[model samples]
Target: MLGVLSAMLCCGAVSAQQHEVEMIPFGNMDQWIDRQIKESGIIGGATKNVYAIGPTATVTETKAYKNMGGSPWATSNVMARVAGITKTNTSVFPEKRGDGFCARMDTRMESVKVFGIVDITVLAAGSMFLGEVHEPIKGTKNPQKMLNSGIPFTKKPIAIQFDYKVKMSDREKRIRATGFSRITDVEGKDFPEVNLFLQKRWEDEKGNIYAKRVGTMVVRYYTTTDWHNNATYSIMYGDITGDPAYKAHMMRLQVEERYAVNSKGESVPIKEVAWGTEDDVPTHLLLQFTSSHGGAYIGSPGNSLWIDNVKLVY
Candidate 1:
């Protein structure tokens, strides 16, 4: 299923400075091991698999750690009941690194016989982010909710960088292109996605969402990289709605050519430099990490993503 993360932040302004930002609490994964053992099992609440998608599932999810010193990071205990066996500890962990730690997100593949007849393979991916996870609601088209609960950030950053390593268990490369969608199925190991959204947003009394784009980055890592930015990042403009050619796509990449990523890992579009101007105030930042490419669907098991040292460079 889709692992959505919600980020929320109050409106404010940050001074302009060339500083290394520590936006994510416990970014080093130092206390994650202890948190895992103590806060594991059932921290938030339990979920029932009424859809009968597979394995007659019931998931015990972790509660969102919202009040942990204004930090919004959270973990879910993704366990499933398959054939009456209670499965526990299926997602989110801190793996040991060289005297430090790295957060590892993984996916599990499950084979279940639906209706006691056809066998179906399902993929379940673990995710981590700076937001809240809303459980799925029955009788609705919504699979799950990972709404943007952002923080008031004002400083303009040159780039967001981190260290990452990927490992895949399956050898199936080359995913077929579904259809009209240009997103052709490609081969390789499993795919993991990292995205950040910095925007000037607000909600009225009626909760109507309105926002002005600031900056963003969408990344897919293949090889392990050490502190690199702009290689695959794009910053957004203040408003992209007026563009007649703007066609909405996945992740709301609706801006026409107002923004673009540098192929050589350097400057973004000149128009993007207009982000975070005096007019655009009370911005909110959202960043998320996941080990799967598909939306609300299981992926190949044994796909692992190790992330470390996420920081913002201003």
Candidate 2:
């Protein structure tokens, strides 16, 4: 029953539109979160289930064009054609400081003509400087955009993107960092929490740098969106450690666990959501959760997140 997608669903569960929606058995993250925080003396309320978390992005495939000559920094060394150090492709490609940085990739595996593309200059602080180019880029590196800045850890998982934000407001004296934690429960019993903390970080230098941060955004969870298909890029990932007071009660009882999904779009039990699902996704993956689903997210309105470090146990 570990990786099985078959769950006894709720016959009457409906969607937000009130149309009859399918409610699969929520993987037991609810009780898991409750049990984890039970001793904290906070009223652990049940929030809406999480859907997509991440491996924020994926590397499919690209073409191998000509390697021109500009950057002496990129492509200086060589090794396994599949993976190598960052600068290998920087010299020839269009670079924005560093547009797209990549390593340890297999273009053949991705089934593309090229390798990978990235916008590595995201980490740079100022407008007129070269940060770190992932591949050959054109023009000055433009700041990248993101669809979602996912959460850090959960019963599910997602790769935190550049747009993710952490905010502190007076409406409630809480600080919410997206994708910071996850919840899990089984048959109403809470599971042990596999927590993730924003343990480390480095500030970018004023000149061309490796990373950048916005005012309200948590620097740890996001990376600038400077990427292209078939190019390579390298960046860092980290977590955020803080608090956004949940409704009524908040405690550590919130633990996280996983349920497996099948080839079909079958639902997982325990009120969790799928943050990420795609053709590139492996056959087996965990049911992830996060605070990033802005409006209907559980607990506080703006206190939601997109979970990170997501993995399912077979």
Candidate 3:
């Protein structure tokens, strides 16, 4: 799931002059939708709360979630029904920040034990992005298939700005736990990251989604820092492969294709064809903030990323 939208860039030292800022709807992180769900009796029958970034409201039903109040944001929190058993997972929250609220994403471990004998544990990293997460997740297989990772965004913005802070896990190595498999170690330290990509996309007759990378901007937090306000990261347009600042491991075309529900209402792969030219105008935009750099079911527990006041600079 992490590879679905993987890309990175260094912080740009751009001057803040003659810049216009536009706030994304609900991007301020001050409003939220709260959901109350009750787990199946087989899983201990407990009520849980799952949250989404949307207009203020409370949902008590267990139905699948759709973006509400015209909000274009979704989180990793979800309601899942597997093998006739319903459960919930929540790693994103709204925390008080000054006079408003900010998003708090945490990397942690979750466990499920049935009858005090059958045990399952998995690592989940908190994330927020500009798309949708199809809910009532059926299974753990192909998690990337469960998400539509971007929204139609035709305009090109110079950079993205936001207030943020992070607490790194500070571990030398990361770990992976899929619940069904034994937890294993992964090479490299885990860092919280932010990514933005613009693409000119089209759909084929077979319902396949394809795109060329039009713009890219990504930043990884290597160390803990205090809240930084109005931090801006410029987007690198067009083919950045030859750029001296490019890091293949972090900014290359997605090795694994991402998924999007097509016009036919079928979930299909979004194949990244190539990088677009420098002057290309994008058809869509993909953006995300996560508490861990690694993909699904992988990360170091206790890592946290806080974000607020997200805006785009023109």
Candidate 4:
């Protein structure tokens, strides 16, 4: 009797059969049936084509493929690239002790503004990005010369400054600036602290380079042809100690990226891909000196000073 009672309470397991149930928590029934079916995630349902893509570092790896050791600058395997603008006869070296980078006066401006793009662009061409010129202000000449003039504070180390324009798309954009640390002693397998100056120039000085900001690019204007001047930002990439690695060839550039918020509270780096010494034009981002106006007030008696010797170092 007990066995029969148990049999009445329990039923036999049935074979797996297909059946449907109400997926809508609460709705107007068939009104959204099609929509519900679409979102139900039914097997073999007309789902949009989707494929899982892993992170870049992950997609780059797979069981069928061999594992690549590290990044381009990895000691086990390092890579360097400085491609883009074709080496035209017009091109000149931006920094010293190197080859194949056209540099010249922008000649597009009449006067420059403080913290303006023209000022930044010209400065890069004139000094950090090209030549480390000692041009002073218009009436106030000799920032560097005044230092050499046996003046007390003027003789002290100077802060490096830079201003530049990163071309913006008609749409929103991101940016990053990276450079190989100046190799003081490549043969010695050693590197020193990577310093950054306020501006991007200093014939010789130990000013704090990274104190104020990191990976910061001031977007002066939002419009392509702007109401505001171009954005100006730069950094000193040389050693304050005046070492030789400050002149060594950078195998690869290590650029850090900074961010800005959008119409939404969402923020992104200034660059989708950090600027590097790649030669590709569109894809390879560079701080090309499109044009400039103002320049350093050279301590010259009469000659107008030129900017030169701009470079990237670790």
Candidate 5:
């Protein structure tokens, strides 16, 4: 579902007609499968090694997952993995659109009463990414890496556009550190986000990693700013806005930060370059979307998001 052309041109003067590039197949939610979990084995009268099936989302034309080194995003069902003692769940389903369908994500909460009653809220989101899923390894921390080596992309895109809808709950909530110690505020407002990353990178003979970010585009809404249905948003190149942690990861590339140090031993600030420039050899292209703002931790339950008709206009 990745190609370049122009068909639906709007809102801008164009020298010639440009066809829209479909980066994700099944983006319209015309196809899906039921949620299934398999038991790998059993241990001491308890179910153990439960994992979700692969290829959750499909591309209508091309074999995107098999051909693209197992694309890491799941749309049909939220793939939640246990991190330490916390279990994360993000449930997704297909909702009827005008004629076809769109992906819908919902947030819910679960309570555990083993030692003491503890309520864990899960903010589900529809997401796609570049990585694999595996069980947490013993003696290892954060066994799964979020980003894998991305697919080969050489073209410079003008904008990333998509259709989305969001509905937030009215009840506000918060998470406490101990029983009554308030630490983080979990507000009623939630959001959906989309991102695109283009990079020129490679590895050395000594297994050292190196990369230069060529371009990126990010669109995120943390509040109930735009809650209309089928709202079209075209994120132009260089339109980057997010939290400081998100911005720092975009600037440093996360491969290595020491490489950007100046002569005074201070890290030099790296800026985001223009899109589609033929300055660096293109090595990777990563695109991801998420519906929840607090997937790293617990979030507000009952928040919902819908998305469809994603395109890359060039």
Candidate 6:
């Protein structure tokens, strides 16, 4: 992936006739970091592999992962330690694509059985984003706070391009499984989605983050689709509330506040106060690809999304 980025950046700019495309570091999904984690001996002592989008390396130590090699990508694959027992969950994988690889995200149920008696099941939806997942997760409380979303980015790209394929679940309604409660049916069908937000953000004296939405681009797949190469979605700048393309359910302000690391090294919530003007330059970019559009712990089990060759068009 880094090699591909280097080649694209070497051209300085693509073609003057066409849109200039800049390959994001590790966005090609060719390289990955593999972690081999050993669960607690009480739970059969199984070794699990968790992956991340970064420099290619195999990590043997069972430790929390931070983004490495200047990569600006993170995944839902993670390790958790709760009640003094260690476990792992992997919903994202690096799948072979031609001579390289692509990210395959699956929405499914993960199970953990303890002492051959207690069995627990949780719904996990695979996701990839431009931020970090704080680990090892201690508990299920406030899952949003456990993630540091977005990254410092100043450029204003016209659109985002990527190759993708989606497989919708066979069920008509989504399901919710929190591992602590019985699974219940959600109202509507789930969809695979891609969202990108550009924001001008700031922090107050109390360490609370606020932002005005500078740009937004969101696309959801309602049905299964074959491989779409170089699919591009234009970024709509400023307040799009009156735009004909706007859909309230998909373009509304984030319902749950996303977290970011503050200057004091504390995770603080980012509040989207309002919309920005068309000319506003952004201070940060929040980009994500997910197998499920619904919130955490909600999705159909068989849904899957595959992505490769992500880029920003200038």
**Who wins the TM-score comparison?**
3
Q: 3 or 4: which has the higher lDDT?
A: 3
Residue ranges of candidate 6 with Cα displaced over 4 Å: 1-17
Per-candidate clash tally:
16, 100, 1, 50, 7, 0
**On residues 1-314, what C-alpha lDDT tens digit does candidate 5 reach at each position?**
12222322222113223555555554555555433333122211222222122333433321112223233344313223333342223356666887977666665543323344354332234455433333222212221232243456776765555677776656566332221233466654555566667766555454444556666555555555443433333333332333222354333344222222223433233222333334554666666666654443345555667666665666
User: Each model's C-alpha lDDT?
Assistant: 0.47, 0.18, 0.89, 0.19, 0.44, 0.89
Give one digit per residue, the lDDT tens place, for model 6 in 74-117.
89899999999999999999999999999999999998888875
For 1-314, candidate 4 gives per-residue lDDT tens digits of: 97774553232111122322111111101111010111111212222211111112322211111112211110000011113111001111121212321122221112222333322111121221211111111222222221111001111111112222222222121111111222121112111111221221111132211111112111122222312121112322222123222222321122323222223433323332222111211211122222211223211111111222222211
Output the worst ten-in-a-row residue range by lDDT, candidate 1.
4-13
- Which runs of model 2 end up more than 4 angstroms from their true locations? 1-165, 173-259, 263-265, 270-289, 292-297, 304-314
lDDT per residue for candidate 1 within 153-185, as digits (tens), equals 776665565667777656465332221223244
Model 3 over residues 1-314: C-alpha lDDT tens digits? Answer: 54332333333635447999899999899999999999988878889989999999999998899999999998999999999999899999999999999999999999987875568898999999999999889988888899998999988899899999999887889999999989999999999999898989999898888899999888899999889999888888999998866778778998446788899998888889899998888988899999998889989998999999999999
Per-residue lDDT of 45 in model 3: 86
In what order do the candidates fall by lDDT, top score first?
A: 6, 3, 1, 5, 4, 2
Full candidate order by TM-score, most accurate first: 3, 6, 5, 1, 2, 4
The alpha-carbon lDDT assigned to residue 302 of candidate 1 equals 63
**Candidate 5 Cα misplacement greater than 4 A, ranges:** 1-19, 38-72, 75-88, 110-126, 135-149, 171-189, 206-208, 222-278
Superposition TM-score, candidate 5 onto the true structure? 0.58
Query: In candidate 1, which residue ranges exceed 4 Å CA deviation?
Result: 1-23, 33-67, 76-89, 110-122, 134-141, 146-149, 169-190, 223-251, 254-279
The candidate, 1 or 5, that scores higher on lDDT is 1
TM-score of 3: 0.95
Superposed by TM-score, candidate 2 places the C-alpha of residue 92 at a distance from the truth, in angstroms, of 35
What RMSD does model 1 have? Answer: 13.1
